[model samples]
Target chain A: MSRLIIPLSAFFFFMAESTYADLFSGEHFNSSRIFVPHFLFIFILFLTIFGSTKYGIIYGFIFGFLFDVVYTEILGVYAFLFAFLALVVSRLMKLVHSNIFIAALISTAAIAALEILVYEANGLIKDTGMNFTEFATIRLLPTLLLNFAFIIILAFPIKRIIEKANFESD
Target chain B: MPQFFLNKRLIVLLVSIIILVALIGFSVREREKLSWPEQFLKDTTGFVQNIFHQPVQFVAGFVENVNDLQHTYQENKRLKTRLDEYVKLKTEVQELEKENVELRDILDKKESLRDFDPIQATIIARNPDMWHEKTIINRGKIHGVQKDMAVITSKGLIGKIKITTQFTSTVQLLSSMDPKNRISVGIYGKGTIYGFIEGFDQKERLLLMKKIPYDVKIKKGSEVVTSGLGGVFPRGLPVGKVEKVESDQYGLTQVAYVKPSAELYDLNHVIVVKRKISTTESSSGAGAEGDDL
Candidate 1:
C-alpha cells in the first residue's frame, strides 16, 4: 500500500499544483503578486528527508520534464533544475534532523533557490522585461509564501507516509 | 584533478548541463511545426489538462451565475429598453446584408475579408511558468484550427493561435513580451488609418500601436480592429480603443496606446476565427508569419 501510495500521491500533488494555480489566477481574484505553485517541489523535499533520496530524485526528474512539456513548452529548464535541486537537498539531509520545523526551514531556503534559478534562466532565454526588484516583490515573495503554506499544511502527513513506506536506497 | 575526472556524479552533472543548453536552444528556435514526439506528448497531456480544467470551470461558472442572479432584475430592465432598438437595428442590418449580397452578385465577386467561420473552443490550461502570456485551448489541426488565426473572447480579440497539435493548440496573448509578436491594426475615426501593434506597455497596461504617419489626426477612443490585410486575421474584429497618442522617438510617425476591449485574463471560452477565403501569402508588413492561410 505504501508503494502504491507514494508515487501516486506525488503525481496528485503535481497535478494539484497546476489546477490550484488555475483556480487562483485571472478574474477570480486579482492580486498583483503572481502565486506559482511549488507543491511538488516541497513534497520532494519531504521525500528526501523521510523516504529515500533515490526515489525523490527520480520522481523530481520525471515530473519536472512533464511540467515543461505540459505547461512551459521549454524542454529542459525544469527537468535539469528539479533533479539538481533534489540532489542538493538530499546532500543537506545528511546533517539535518527530520523534524517538521527543521524540514520547513530548509525547504524555505530550497524554495528560494528554485525560484531565483528559474527566474534567471527564463530571463536569460526569453528577455522578460521584469527587473530583479519587480520579480522579487511581485512573483518570488508570493510564490514562496504560497508554497510554504502548502508545506505547513501537509508537512506532517507527508513525513509520516514516507517513513511508513520504508524506502531503501542502499 | 584525476580523482575528479573519475567522479560519477560530476560527470552526470556536466552531461546534464550540456543537454540543458542544447534543449533550450532547440526549443527556442522558430520552427514551422512541432516534431512528432512533441505533438504526441502535447495531445496526451492536453487530454489530462482538459479533464482537470472542467471541474474548476464548472465551479467558477456556478459562482458567476450566483453573482449574476443578484443583478438579474436590473439587467433585465436595461435589456428591455434596448430590445426595441435592437429589433429596429436587426432589420436594418438584414436589409443591408441582402443589398450587399445582391451588389456582390452583380459584380461577380466571390470573397470578402470579413468572411470567416468561428469555431468555439474551451481553455484547457495556461502557461504555468507565467514568463510568457500563453494558453492552451481544446481545438487544433484536426478541428481546422491553424497557426496565426485570430482568437477572441465574447468581449473582443484576445490572441492568435501559436501552435496546433492534433487535439490542442497554444495561443500567444497580445501581452506577451515576444519581440516578434505583432498585429496589423486599423484605427477607425473619420477614415481608417493603419499601423502595427508593436509591443505592450507593462507599466501602463496598454498595447503600443506604431508606424502611423505623424500627420494623420487620430482621435482619442477611436476603435482599432484587424484590417485582414494582416493576411491571417479577418477584417473588422474588434481589438481595442486608443487611449492616448504620441510621436515616436524618430518623430517620423505617431504611436497610440490601446486598451484591449477583451479581458485576456481568466479565459474560459474562445472563438477561433477561421477565414473562409484562402489568401495567398503577401508581404503586407509585420503580421503574416505563416505561409498558408
Candidate 2:
C-alpha cells in the first residue's frame, strides 16, 4: 500500500502539473476567477483520512514545489499553503460521504478563493494597484465555474482509478 | 500502550539505522559530494524519469507527424510539376556534371578547407506560444553536440545551440522574434547591408530590414546572406531574400519585406555543424563555399 501510494501520488502530481500549466497559475485569468483543479487536493484529502497525515503533508510539499518551479512563482509559498489546505480538507473529509465530484468542486472553489486573496495581497505589497474586483469577476469566477464543470465530468473515472489501485494494493 | 505491540529492541535498531544514515547524508552534503548510494539514486531517478516521459514524447511525436503530413500534401502538388522540369534539365545537367568534376579538381588545387563531423538532428518538440522561439533538438551532449555549435539546414543558417544535456538541447532560432537578433546581411552582388530582423506580429512572419537607407539600391528580388560579422554564424550563408520594399515616414530608410528560405514550420532534417576537433584541412573552408558534407 505504501509503495503504491508513493508512486500513485507522484503520478497524480506530474499529471496535474502538465495539464494545469499556464491555466491555474493565475497568470491567464483575472483576480475574480483564479482557480485550481482539485484532483491532487482530493487525493491528499482521501489519503489523510484513510491512510496517513504524514504522507499527505509529504505529497503536498512535493506537488507544491514542482508547481513553484514551473509557475515562476515564489518558492515554498504554495508548498506551505497546500500543506495547510490539505490538513483542513482532510478534516472536512471526515464529515462528507465519499463523493469525489462534490469534494473536488468544493475544494477547487475554496482554493481559488484563497489564491485570489494571496494574489491581491501580493499586488498590494508591490503597489501594482491592479484591481482585484476586475480580476475576480473576469478571471476567478470563470475559472471556478470551468474547473467545477471539468471536475463533474472527470471525477467518476479518476475516483474509480484511485479506488481500484488502492483495492488492488490491499 | 499504543506501541506495546512492537519489541523495544527492534525499535531501537530501526532508530539507530536511521541516525547512521542521517550522519552519512549530512557528511556527504557538507562535503558537497554524492556518496555511492546517492549517485545510484540519482541515476535510478533519471532512468525512471526517462521511462515515464515516453508517453509525453509520443504525444509530441504524433503532433509533429500530423503537421508533417499536411506539409507533405502541399509539397507533393508542387513537386509533380517540378519533376517534369527536372527530366528536361537532366541532359544539360549531365554535361555540366562532367565539367563540374574538372572544375572541382582545379578548385582543389587552388584552395583547401577543413573537414567537419556534421550530424543531422530531427526537432522533437517546439513551444507553440513562442512560435519563432527556441526549439528542442533530439541530439544532446551525449551525441557530441556542444553549446555554441552552429545549426543549419541545406538552405541556410537556422540557429545555434544554447543549452544541452545528455538527451536534448534547446536551439535559439535566428527568427526568435526578439529585437536583440541583429543579423549582418548582404545582398548578393552588392556591398553588405546590415540590419536587424524581428517578428512583426502574431502572424508567424519575419520583419526584415525595417529601416535601410533609401539610397541603397535594393531590387525586388535579391538573396540575403549572413555577413559573418557575428562570431556565432559562419560567413556567406543564405538567410532570406527581399520580397517587397516600402518607405517609412520621412523616407529616411526603406522598409524591405523579406521571406526566409527555409520553411521553419516544416523543418525535418537539420545538420548541427560540428566544429573541426582537429585542423587537418580536410574539407576545410566548407562554410565559405558550396555545401560539402
TM-score of each predicted structure versus truth: 0.90, 0.51
Q: Write the per-residue lDDT of candidate 2 for residues B7-110, one digit (tens) a residue.
A: 88467546644653454345322132233543343334334444554575566569878988989977999999799899879988999978877898978853
Alpha-carbon error at B209 in model 2, in Å?
Answer: 5.2
Candidate 2 lDDT at A99 equals: 66
Which candidate leads in TM-score? 1
Q: What is the lDDT of residue B223 in candidate 2?
A: 79
Q: Give lDDT tens digits, candidate 2, residues A1-170.
A: 63575557555554543334312333333232234444555555545444555666677766654443223123344455566666666666656774665577556755585457556534533332235675566445665676567667766665554555553444
Taking the candidates in order, what DockQ does each have?
A: 0.57, 0.10
- Which pairs clash in model 1? none
Compose the digit string of candidate 1's lDDT tens values, residues B1-293. Answer: 24434579788889989999999999888766888988998898888878877787899889989999999999999999999999999999999999999999999998999999999999887776677778889999999998889999988899888889999999988888877788888976767899988778765668999889999998899999988876778888999999999999999999999999998777888999998777645545544454322
TM-score of chain A of each: 0.92, 0.68
Please tell me how candidate 2 rates in CAPRI terms: incorrect
